[model samples]
Target: MICRSCNQEHNNNFCPNCGEKRDVEKITLTSMMSYAFASVTNMDKGFLLNLKMLLLKPQRITSEYLNGKRKGILNPISFLILSVTLYLVVLELFKIPKKPSDISKLPSGTLETLGNMSYKAGQFIRTYLKFFWILAIIPLGLAQKLIFRKYNFTEHLAISSFIIGQATLVGIISYLILRWPLIFDPVIYIMITWMVYRVFRTNNKLDSLLLAFVVLFLFILQLILITFLIGLSQV
Candidate 1:
């Protein structure tokens, strides 16, 4: 059989050249519906199992994923996306708290400009919160890729995704128990500290812990950078 994708001749269930299925199914209403349903509702991607393994051994997931382990685990970006979705659902269901005060009401002057920027930044953090959470991963990944130089930028992104995904889950739990969701910060940082240590896994415990603190600083710096950019764009 000639592979339709790469045109390599092979008689097998899948094309060895590109791994495309040998017999492509015709697009029918039933098949389309099934595909859509699976894409949306497929827990067989192993959300719970992946979450467990992610907590236990995040670094392993990053390495194994790059090594082409694609079965029974959620990809890093997908995990982050799913975590965001779950976080949003919990936020809606629980109605966590009031958002930051309206940015429109800041008093006029340089003070007002600064205040407006600050207010808008707070609003940005809360509104479209999921997108902000995802963007936070970018700076972190870039920082790790540059600083560690152990893995390439893409690998660092996978690590960052897992870190943020786990953060979102921790935030959900904090949101449930805490009256003020602002408390979510300390909890998330603690969890990420552990993740960072595990990812780097140095023999020097002190260095790893300090480096984990650096990870927290990096995230905070990214948040401020994003806010600055957003503020400037509106100005």
Candidate 2:
């Protein structure tokens, strides 16, 4: 059979040339739902296991993946895609009430103008949530790479992907599923710090914890600055 991906002929279940599936079935509602179900619940493909591992051992999962021990585990970016996809789906299904934008709480004058800009920036980010996630990934990865010099930028990127992906899931679940308010949202920061500390704890526990907080702070500050600039550009 000819491989549709690379136009190479193959006779295997997966394309020997490009690895496209041999049995590319026609798309249908039944097929779509079936594929989604299997992909989400299927243990063989490492979906559920990846989810469990992300919750229980987030650092080990990424560390092992970077250390070339990847086998049954899902790729970090793929996990991020899955997490983002699910977050969007859940968001659409459940319209959690948006907190009313309080312009009066602004500091007046220039800061107030900046506040409005930030609000617009936030609106833009919310509309392009999936795309903005990529923005967050780079900064977080840079922060991680800076503090943990042993791991290179790309390795930290893998770590950031895993960290943000898991944070997205946990954050959405806490807000939408568990009915937690936005004020309690600092849990996500704590979660990120925990993942970073755990990944670097082999050197020195106290130092690792301090550096993890630093990483988290730097990531947040960078994210805010970039996002604010994005907001500023709209004006």
Candidate 3:
């Protein structure tokens, strides 16, 4: 038979030029089921493998990805999207306590109260979760340029996305844990720092520690800003 892919003439099962396998007969229901199961098995195996690599050898994985060895590893953006989506869904399922001073509970006495509540809600979402990528991306890109000596913003962006993705995963876990047993905000911050350091190959432990502190401080400041805006809106 003539193999169209390689334009090769072959009398046997595969093309001699490009090794294209011969087309099989129409798939039966049983064959389809088998194929589906096989696909599922392969997907599960790949997911687990990638997950383990991401957690255990995060630095290596990031380096490999930057070096263009990215076939088996999960794409960083896809990983980020999946992780963030899952985290948000899980967080919705398990509610976190808002501070008593939260503007959402402010009495609706005036237009200010309404505006403040709206602003607070928007700020809370943007500062805490929605704008995380935007805030982290630029700093992370700069960090890469400084630490790894990589000037390519795209590469830095990839690393930044991965770090944030991992951080979001940790944040979700921390949120879940804080729901019942503990409020380990410090630990969560540490984990996020560690994830960023790993991704960026930041060798200086002190610098990483400082960066972590800055990140926590910024988060707290964002909270304060949101609260202040809420109060102002009420006035």
Q: Provide TM-scores for the models.
A: 0.76, 0.78, 0.60
**TM-score comparison, 1 vs 3, better candidate:** 1
- Highest TM-score: which candidate? 2
Which residue pairs in candidate 3 collide?
112-233
- 12: Cα error in model 3, Å: 8.3
Total backbone collisions, model 1: 0
The 10 consecutive residues of candidate 2 with the worst lDDT sum are 175-184
- For lDDT, the strongest prediction is 2
Cα-based lDDT for every prediction: 0.77, 0.79, 0.63
Candidate 1, residues 1-235, lDDT tens digits: the string is 8999999999999998899999998999999999766655665555665677677877777678778887877778888899888888887898845655665677788978888777666666677677877877888887676557888888788889988888778878887786445324677767877888887877898887787778677767876778888866656
Question: Judged by TM-score relative to the true structure, which candidate is superior, 1 or 2?
Answer: 2
Ranking by TM-score: 2, 1, 3
For residue 221, model 3's alpha carbon misses the true position, in angstroms, by 8.0
